[model samples]
Target: MIEKAKDLYAQLIHAQELVDNSTRRKVLIDSMRELEASGVNCQSCTGCCCTFISNSMQTDGVQTLELYIYLHDKEMWNDSLISRLNEVIKNNRLDYEISTGQGSSFRRTYTCPFYNSGPKGCSISPESKPFGCLAFNALGKGVSAGENCTSNIEVLKQREDIFENNEQRANVYLKSILSLDWDKLPMPVALLRLHESIGKIL
Candidate 1:
């Protein structure tokens, strides 16, 4: 399933080199560059995605890739993991961690599977380059709902116009992935049984 999904994913991507507005893309790119230079500590905080499950759609570019791979690797998705998945489905949550007040739309590892922790550094660094890594520019108050802001990622303050197009494109890309076999989409965590489910449903 993984290989097939990868191939299909590649094919769909190659089929259309959707040209993003060059000016908007450049602005987003510049924001990314500026954000990197600002030196915010994403590695240290790790944020909600690391522990809390993301209730949001799989649109977050590289995040979806990481999530899909994390769900499949049977080595990680054990019986306990399956049970967790069921609970998430039953509860209609992305996932939650009371230990740290993390909540998700569904129950799952909101933390990226590729995440590697070591004294030296995280296995995946922003510098490594990934498309979906969100550097969301927001209107105001960019911290935990109630937490005091240490400092705002000024990029979040950048022109909202920049993100409007990019976010749309990213979403379109992810949805294309989800559309391949909607009849029997992968259920629960690994999203592995999708084909089987589709087969049975048909």
Candidate 2:
């Protein structure tokens, strides 16, 4: 499973031109840079966005594979990570599926396993982090629900436009690796399922 994910990552890197020249991605990056310059960023406050309080951060197979490879390279793909993911799922009832009508079902939200409650913030690098994570940013100078933070829907839409096709292809490839049929899933659940595919007991 790891090897297959690596192969996919390699293929993505090989075709990096689209990513490099994507105008939508450039706009999103520029917006982030502007926020940083204006001192409107997530710094001192706790990671409310990463928690299940109001977060439902979902990721497709491509985003999951990016994070998986990043963790493996950083020596973070170990028993500790597995345990954290499992605990998050069990504690928050993330395994339970809710019917969204029209024969669609979705999993519950939970704190992301990669969220380090420290200065480092997210364990995953910006490049490997999910688009939803990236687009959720601070809107003001300090913490406040109304003006302090929110998800930039426009930025998220821009990124989705740029990578939608890649996400579709990745989900198709990943279906052969795991028994799951979900195209996009809660971040922790997806990662845990992928790790379990290798039969490595937590």
Best by lDDT: 2
Worst 10 residues of 2 by lDDT: 15-24
Q: Please, what is the whole-model Cα lDDT of each candidate in the order they appear? A: 0.39, 0.70
- Residue 133 error for model 1, in Å? 5.9
* Tens-digit lDDT track of model 1 for 1-202: 5565455345434553323223323544566556546652243332443333332223343233434444454345456655655664456443332233453233233443344443212334343223333343222233332132222344434534455554445446555555432221113432433333222321
The C-alpha TM-scores of every prediction are 0.40, 0.82
Compared with the true structure, model 2 gives a TM-score of: 0.82
Highest TM-score model number? 2
Candidate 2 RMSD to the real structure: 3.8
lDDT of 2: 0.70
For candidate 1, the lDDT comes to 0.39
